[model samples]
Target: MNQNRVQASEVAPRAGLADISILANASLTSVTGTDMTSNAQGSYDLALKYSGTGLASVGVADKKVLVYALPAELQGKVVGGATVDIDANLLPITPGDIPGVSLLFGALGTAIDGVDKLVAIPAVKAAFDSLSTIQNLGAYQETLPATVSPDGKTISVDFTQGFGKYVHQAYVALFDTLRDTIAAIDVKNPIAAIPVKLLQEASADLFAIIDAIADGTSDILDNALNANLLGSMNGTLHTTVSDPGVASATVKAGAINNALISADVLTATEQEGEAVTLNFPTTAVNPIENYDVAAPVITQPVAGQTQVAGQVTLTQPIPDGTTFEAVVTLPDGSTKNVPLAADGTFVVDTGSLVDGQTISAKVVATNGTYTKDSPITTATVTAAPIENPIADYNVATPSVAPLTAGDPEITGQVTLNQPIPLGTTFEAVATLPDGSQLTGTVESDGTFKSAGVDQLAAGQTVTNG
Candidate 1:
């Protein structure tokens, strides 16, 4: 075979130890340092520990392997990635870690950060299942970490010292991302006219937090932060023993950030933070009729609050389709992937939706978590028509007078506006010149008629004719 033709080299022989140092991101086992040799094809032995943590109650449980750039010596010649064949007993299975690794050796501390796959879904589910109670009912507060530097000075920040720093930062990122994402889920447009007071307070809070970080202390949080964000999009509320359900459990709430909440008019015609309407093209792939999206119409400003008029109309003519879509551009560097039902301009059967009731619909696209509650319509919702006997009785048909007994007729038809039952009886009791009562049988069809009466009471022109 040609030397250039690549082939799996056969195992040559065993050798001495090589330069290797394995540090566990989580709690480690027996070995913190070890050595391995090129077993014919650059294979090495590694002794590692579960030395660190991903998060406190949240560590990688599975046996993970953090592959690194071949320790400088084997850098250029090393292949794209490495594959480790473990002695089945050493790593029977993968751990519940973010990065499922057994042996972790980084050129530096940053190597752990590069470990992409932290933990698998099964592991995450298993691990999080242990904290079901707290996970289901906890508010994600922003993280407050200790600082080491003062203002107006450059300092070498060592992020590698404490494991809690990594975990805390991760928690903050996770919490904030989740909180904001979920808050923006229920409707299309929310937080258009944010309270100026809220923005100022948030800015103050950030300033205080920065001061703390610069002065080497815990960071500060502001009350301006949306306290109800966790519960807004139905997050922090679950009834099962599983997480990573993502669909049934994982919820995004709000994306309210400093960037999204700004208020300085820059352009002549455009206000700095004006809420703009999203018009879709009339020639759309889906029309508005197909969707069941209905939002509350915003009215004039209220006494103490600025009314935000939020309406989601289809730029594209949504025919009788079911799926609604919009490529919304938010104030922040984010996109609104709204695949919500295209309910034109009004919220659903919203009991009139007038009582300061906010209109919120399910968001369809990925990462939709906020409720778009606009100004409520003034229309009221009355109770639907009911089935009651009293109503039916009081509302009767037009009244009619009963037939008289002196009326005369031979073969005339009669009719009653009211319905007559099958057994109703009537008779044609006529009289002849002989003074005997004229008899005529009534038909089964409830009709009676007579034909013979030539001469009768001539002086009495009115002989019951």
Candidate 2:
């Protein structure tokens, strides 16, 4: 067959999150090509740009194709079972697309026409002592050659396409000896280098599947390549630094996630800023959370208030007149009592919250006093108090800067132990299921006093804010 290399860039949009660049060129280094004497090479190299920040850019190569980096916001709460998409962009085509088996054989020289060459391949030590020198010779003069593929139709050849008519007769003779030797190996590692020296002989065939064009062929390669992409690791490996002095920088190796990892990989051995190497084996799995849906977006905090109020107002998907009540459960297990309007909203008085608290929320459909037994949708919210002057607490119209009557913001009050150094920031903080976090701005004052940063991520437990 004849064709052109499918343009991965032009096809990127159809593939979505999967990396198109890596699938076309990368190979694994640890894997030896099926041939020891042919034009085989180890795994490919795939490079990706650092597109995210802080936590999101932790480059972890889980496989030649599998790459992973956590998001900054999803940090800490990430668990081991989190699921990520292995982009389908690398999978090969379907069986129907090709004339026969799912494997695609393209325009390169084929078994019927190409010259063949054989090279000694490393064998498992178990059979090494008994292996005959006669079996070791790659020549077909003394022994018969094995067919390129099991179907008995394919012929193997190197990319260079050397040799003459003598090669034809040599192939049939050498094929048998190589086949016998390969059959002699343990079946458990059929694909391993020591057993499938058949692959070294068949490298040309495998290459075709990656480089050819067919309906499902590229998709098959896309899927296979995607399985090893870096972002698929699903578990975490963590390391921590002790008492790193304030002035002394202490760095520890970041966590590693290795699920879906089929091969060993390279990583940074030292801390964040240091240059190093991490030789990973086949077992590292990264910990992550498989959110069933797009993570609920965090709404911007109402203006004026330093803490974002723990509240939400969603329009009913079914239509009008539906109302729900919200019961806020503090990290301490105490629940808040509140009404959800027919417009679909509930709010927590974040202004009265305490520091360093964790919270989560659950909602139940209700009409004032009678509550329904339906499943409750949940969210998380965390709010901490600030030390702004009580004088700021006149509570007129519940006005927070940029405030809206519908979703009023709750400002926290806090006193800095010292004047914030020049260029230093004083931010508001809120407590939610993830953890208590520093929030908004203080406008150059060491006294934090803004409402913008105290946004609420959906599904988080709501506390005072």
Candidate 3:
């Protein structure tokens, strides 16, 4: 990498213009010593100073445009510069033709500040009411480019129109006057600029404005102002200097490095003291056009669900030429890619997952243009229930013996359709002919024997007991 610093601290301004000096400091990788190459990236930290005679003649409201003409080698390769800055000396800031809805935000901030201070006045209230119309507009947002010409040889800065213009004249003028008025009012009355009744209403109006903007109404306003948003090739607001003969001010153009690197400015070789001319144009030749690139959306395997065993399908349609992959994180801290069928469905084997463990899945889609990852969907593992086995068995009729005096007994058999478990036991209860009962134990062979069979009357008979 080669580094160079072009310092022109004593450069004389135009005969009638302010004395201006520019210092260009950059480190381009392709530039080694005094030689340079083509298409190499580099960093730029440029600073400019304007002072001396005739600077006072530039009125606060007047527009000041500064243009830098670079070598032809740096043409058509610039990109990326941003941010708007200003000095406190520049009071009553003016609005500019910024490149995007950022102007609206800037103005919105001023309007909010003004409303905070002077909302008690009917006129301020009316202006706030008018500003509320922005609630219906769409936010006009897009990718903005660096301020470089198509040839990439010139970098322009419209100081007065770009920076000063961002400070809303309407809000600033109105509130500045109101603030002065409030400062003059007698402390005893204090009610002229700060009305008691309108105080609550003003707060409500402020909240309403914020709520409307939050609810997407700013899109309309954004779109309306998209033509001049911050990222556009518009210049930044450096500072306002006012002195007897001259005002020394250091102005830094942020993101200009990206612009230089993107444009391959390092490829252009120039001597240390080569004269770089600064020109002024009445209008910006290139106005940024609004464009949008939609990001892929994911709608399948809905996020936040529990699954025991099932297939999760990617319901979202993938564009042609785009590649899709499903990433699954398993319970054991391992990740795997689940293959998807043509229909975008893939089943996860929950049986393999441990109980109480959670698995997550997401889809990544990539194409020549861009890549996108879907929101993560997770499923918890749950164990299935367990059931005991049922036994198959049958019972046989009991055999009764004659009740001979004191001896009375009954025998029966109980068998199982399957093999008998080793420690299994059974018992039987017999009902006598006289409605009495006796108990007995059954052997593993399935035989049952009992005693205490009682005799019955003539119509009754001895029954197994």
Candidate 4:
């Protein structure tokens, strides 16, 4: 038998039998030759074996291959010339001669044919193409060597291949998809549960979902807690207390509301068709019992009145033992305080008030923290009456001048104790020489000159009529 005989070129080109290597003892060798012997004319039994070994350290070892041949007719015969002419042929063989090898080869060939048929299917081919594309993706192609932990419960993935740069994008994309899916779910009628397989496959994503739900619940609770009904009621009570009549009620109501909220009996949110009733305890004291006192009202010396007697009176009666003071604003812009009498009436002296001057006065209840002022009242001072002027007539020294005629003319000036009226005339009569009258108009200086006095003698007494 020629053990190193190369196979005829016809067998070398057959599909699934080309360029095959079988490994043994941690080494690889190619099936480069065949052992054959002629059992009879035109008949042969052949056996194939691989030779050589690969590196044991690389883990490519202890591998073997089995070959089986089939007896079949050739379509063409070899010519007797130097160049042989042959045609392609198909063969059929009986497998009883090397049952072990035949069975193994049969099983492997069946499996390969089945795989070939599956790959030929269009849908399967498309699925394989998609898988190939995914495998080639930048994110997936970045591989990490996996390491088992010491206790075998955890595996660590290597991060030497720029894992964060690529894998983070994939993680972000996955989370975005998950967020969108959750957002599309209707909260009113949400799905009962996530699919178990999906949860198992994406536990990280499920954790994210749980976190989102927890955050939303926390926000809702925060908002509810912040809507403090007790606080709001307290504010309302503060505003209501400004009105003295409702102060006691508002305070009691606020206390009750606070107690209810503290006891969790009241919700922060307003409920429809429900009212919060605040009941005060029987022993609760009224807050505004002493707040009934008000600012005094002045009615006696009415506004815009002239006080001839320079006194003011208040008509509104005060309680017994309640003393009040009046703030009087004089016309000169100065202020004075006057005490009220026991009857709530106050008198203001007009000594400081000028005639015809207007003054403002307001009454302030005194001797208590609740003291308040009344509305301002205005009054004018009375004008003084005019006095009549007095008049007195007096005699003046007479002077006589010698005239060319028979009698000398007498001239004299008369004076009055007070000035006379502008249009009044004064006259003097002398009885020494002749009965004659002398008259002159009085001037503003209370002096009068008697002019054109004819036949007037010296030292003659001049009298006015």
Candidate 5:
């Protein structure tokens, strides 16, 4: 049973009920209507009421309501008719409205079937031909403002300005055909075919319309006469437009309190007209002090020195209201600060340092704007050399002889009145006239000698003690 057939340019009219006028009387179980117009004829009358009962031979077909083009395979299919009670007021389209069957013949004016009256009017003309095929798909042609609510039981279908231009022309033609089909695939033998629940419902409706257009909410559709569109449900519609003025006043109230702290208080009815509830103070304060000081180690006048007096020990330990100073730097390049003394010791009187010069120290420390410095430590003054005093010493009289007779010999020569600094050593006392006290060690230039002097009684006299 392949049937299908419906195209006569898909039949039209429904818009404002095109010049309607149905009026059947003769007690035909009801069917009333008056001069309804529209197509600019404008008289808009649509009430088609009728209560059950054998609508008396249904006869009175006057000013057209002929509608018939359904067949896009009987849309939401379900067409069997013969009940008849009737009730049409129409006007409530919205699914990207336009070519309409006045809401599927006003919801099939209830069980209607004056004898197969076009069998459920082809499922209400296949539900307005599926809302004129989704208002002409692709870049979705337009048409979407269907409001009706004042107690008429809500219809509201504002595709927020044509759903943000049909989701930005369907995400720019689906990412430019997925970047030209992944740049003509073959990335090392690549293969692809994904629909994964329609790309996760188009990535959760494009991140909930980018988090409701970054918080100014209203689900995006700022109406420049509509076309910003993009509501896909989540909290329906909102964005009545307002965000553009921050170019650059240098932007910083702590970067707008760190970008609205955590946002959520801008009420004044979401502000566009009056509702202004701002209140920002989320507590938490202190955050800008900053500090650093570590570099003070010197520890006193050490490294090869000859004279440096008084305090200068710093292996760093002055941190409670810190204050040290000590500079120095002198080998003629003059410099001197010198204060320290709260434990990191320091004293600098170098007494006009001389004798081999060279000073160099460094200690710094401060602490309110933090300061640091301590790596120079040098020293060299050398001053301890002066000696000249040996007034008299010329002992050279020791001649006791007896060698081959009894074995006794003593000989000597020592003289140093003044010139001593070459490995000096002098100790010679010899009173050998039977009195003996001898020691020898004065040689470099002054001499002293003794040859086993034990038998020294020859003439018994060798004195020079």
Candidate 6:
């Protein structure tokens, strides 16, 4: 369980898109760790040098830059219960100078007002309620208010762990709930003159897009954390942003996949100004190792004539609070884990194993403190006995009898000493006293019936084959 914390230096933050001039020379300088409640707090220091035409030209006034750590990527690396904090020193643009920032906030308020009015309509309210019950129609946000720095030149982004995963879970849960709800709705009913069936279809299409966005975003986040930038300076940093124009800038953009980081901004701005310095920091973590233990005993398996597989047993008994997992490796290099029964017996399915194929098996035993694997046992799969085909033979005895009293129709049975193959049928022919032949099919069980035996007399001699 020993591991090392991933450093921000390992992943260089790419500058915002080339079109975003304000972020021309943005780059991560260093990442430092501080002891937190359960684990260390990850702090990333980034510097963005202004190299654009001007903040006035970019319409970015009062727009706060954001940086977020991906919790999905840090699951086993950090302890939970750590709070995420954003330092107030990252915003350099002056709030008073940006008049458009007010306009942006005003526009957002107007949009909210419009939504409130729409929700007042009975039909609209029902639809909205339906969506809300399935999932939060509103965007997911855990607002942590941060103020602009007085000087506004240096920005430090610190996110410990857990929060990003919570956000991710919220998103996944929303989509999953919505998908399930839509699937359960009765499609035959009409809502607002539109068939509910159509809504279900539209939901399926929407889910496809959501899945792509969710999976792609997760991949980008994962790549940002684990990408091997061993020797290359090019790397991607995960980030988030806040702006007056939207409830949560990251949510408005549909997620942090499009957040602006300093690496690319720094690189681009440096080409226009002086070189910016970059620093990388790293930390190590170690976990306790398990003590060595003894391996379990294994028993060989034998293929049976009727079964496609063989039974492999654990001859030795296990102690309480212990568990064992057995894995079998076939000659083709495929491995299968077989679960043991209460008696410690497991079936090694060799139906797919070719003739003369060899197999090896081992058992891993785990107690409260340690896990140990048993010695590998190898054996050739035993071939099952070949079955002989049913021998061909003629019916030993064929006889006829009256099916009912005073009736010409008759029923009879043929006899054989050996077992009859299933689905086997035979044609039964009988010669009546009038020299006419009556024929019927004999079932595999040797039973048959025939009609139109008008000349048949009881107790009279009749020929049959």
Best by lDDT: 6
Task: Tell me the deviation in Å of residue 383 in model 3.
Answer: 4.4
Over 4 Å off, model 3? 1-309, 314-318, 322-325, 342-354, 363-377, 391-410, 419-442, 450-465
Error of 5 at 409 (Å): 2.7
Ranking by TM-score: 6, 3, 4, 5, 2, 1
lDDT at position 287, candidate 6 = 13
Candidate 4, 108-135: lDDT as tens digits? 3343234434333233223323322322
TM-score quality measure for candidate 4:
0.20
C-alpha lDDT of all candidate models, in order: 0.26, 0.29, 0.38, 0.31, 0.33, 0.39
Ranking by lDDT: 6, 3, 5, 4, 2, 1
**Residue 374, candidate 1: C-alpha displacement in angstroms:** 2.3
Q: Write the per-residue lDDT of candidate 3 for residues 1-465, one digit (tens) a residue.
A: 123223454454322111221212311211121121111112122323212111223332344333444454334323344222222122222222222323443454454455446434444444444443432211111222224556654554444433333323322332333233323333234433344333334434443443443454433223333222222122222211111111111111221212232233222222221232322222221111111112222223322333222233443333323456677766776777765556665555433445566777776665433556666777655565453233433444455444444454667766544455455567777776567778889776767788656544444544442
Off by over 4 Å in 2: 1-322, 341-343, 350-356, 367-465
* TM-score of each model, paired residue for residue: 0.16, 0.16, 0.25, 0.20, 0.20, 0.26
Better of 2 and 3 by lDDT: 3
Q: Where does model 6 exceed 4 Å of error? A: 1-62, 68-258, 266-288, 291-358, 362-380, 385-411, 414-465
Clashes of 1: 70
User: Weakest 10 consecutive residues, lDDT, candidate 5?
Assistant: 248-257
Q: Specify the poorest-scoring 10-residue window by lDDT in model 1.
A: 234-243
Candidate 5 off by > 4 Å: 1-323, 327-336, 339-349, 352-365, 369-408, 411-420, 423-435, 438-447, 450-465
For every candidate in turn, the CA RMSD to the true structure comes to 30.8, 31.9, 21.6, 46.2, 31.5, 20.8
- Give the range where candidate 6 is weakest over 10 consecutive residues by summed lDDT: 246-255
lDDT by residue for model 2 (203-320), tens: 3453444234222234442333223222211111121111111221211111223222212212221212111122222322111111111111223333233332234444223211
